[model samples]
Target: MYKGERMVLRFSRGQRVAHWALAVSFFVLLFSGLTLMIPSLAPLAKGGVARMIHRVFAVVFMLVPVYYALADRKGLQALITESFRYDRDDLLWLLRMPRYFFGRVKGMPPQGRLNAGEKIHHALIILTFITISLTGLVLWFGKGNLSQNEFLGMVMLHDIAMYIMVILTIGHLYFTFVYGALQGMVTGYVNEKYAALEHAKWLASIKAEKTADGKLPQSKSA
Candidate 1:
């Protein structure tokens, strides 16, 4: 940024806290789950230790929504609402996704706080989390009540949901590094150029809401 040019707030403190809480719990669950499934890692799963760890983190994973609601209800609401509310520009942005994937993002249509790809990714994450949580509950509580085939089906569904989240996380990490988006989550702010390039509509909204003293509103992201 040029000297004296202000950086824009991209995420609020509550938003970042909820995000990191989800991330840390998700990774812990993933690691413990892998130890249970992988042959070479079976030694780590012996004595039910890994199972216990998995159960503990599973509760944390399931509580992510509650944490987000308590921490930043407005941000969570915006994420859910904007993810499903696409417009003409969002469609245009989706059509130019190949360019985005290749890191050539300059010419894409202006996007809201979430671009089209992010909308799809966030939607899938929310959907997969719900499925995973439900299946996990059944596997945990219905162990004795469920028949053999029914139990197996619930386990399969749980694994599928986990696999989907794993894939989504990979893509998410790639884009974060590719676009230097980690700064936003880390500092709750982003460079003006980045805000313009990736979230012009959101930046404009912020500008429109600037107060008489030129201070920005203390609201959640988007």
Candidate 2:
């Protein structure tokens, strides 16, 4: 932010906090939940400790969206809006995404702040959260209140959702590492050059707004 240095705020403080909180809670849930499915891991989850930990983290994970909505309303709303709305460039980006695995991004279509792939990831997370949370709650509290068949059905759905989440998380980490994007989450800033190359439309919009107002746009206050 000095006279010659250039950088952009890729994530705000509130967004960063919410993101890491959810991430930590997710990992805890994932490890603990995995013990239930893998018999060899039983000792680690012995005496129902893992189940207790899983349930605790599950509450934190499920509340993340609500926390984000309250803490960073504008950012959360913008992300939600962008995730559900797509255009020609998004379609083109989807078609060209495989090339991105090879570090070839130049020929890809111009991307908004959240690209098509990111939108899909977000959509998957949202849907998974709903399904997993509902099934989890039923499993946790529906005993005696629900039939045996109904309980078993919820358990099946819960496992399916967890598998989907695990797959998506792997892909998410792969892309994040390939792009060296973890810094943005940690520092809330990204190099201007990187932003220009990866999120041209969003960077251009920010510059345009700064030019028009003679100052950078401010994040909505929590």
lDDT of 2 by residue, 115-192 (tens): 889999888887888999999998888767888889889989998888998899999999888888898789887777
Estimate, for each residue in 25-45, the C-alpha lDDT of model 1 and write its tens digit.
899889988997889998999
TM-score of 2: 0.92
Candidate that would win on lDDT: 1
The TM-score between candidate 1 and the true structure equals 0.93
lDDT of 1 at 110: 94
lDDT of 1: 0.86
Task: Name the runs in model 1 displaced over 4 angstroms.
Answer: 1-5, 211-214, 218-222
- Cα error, candidate 2, residue 213 (Å): 0.8
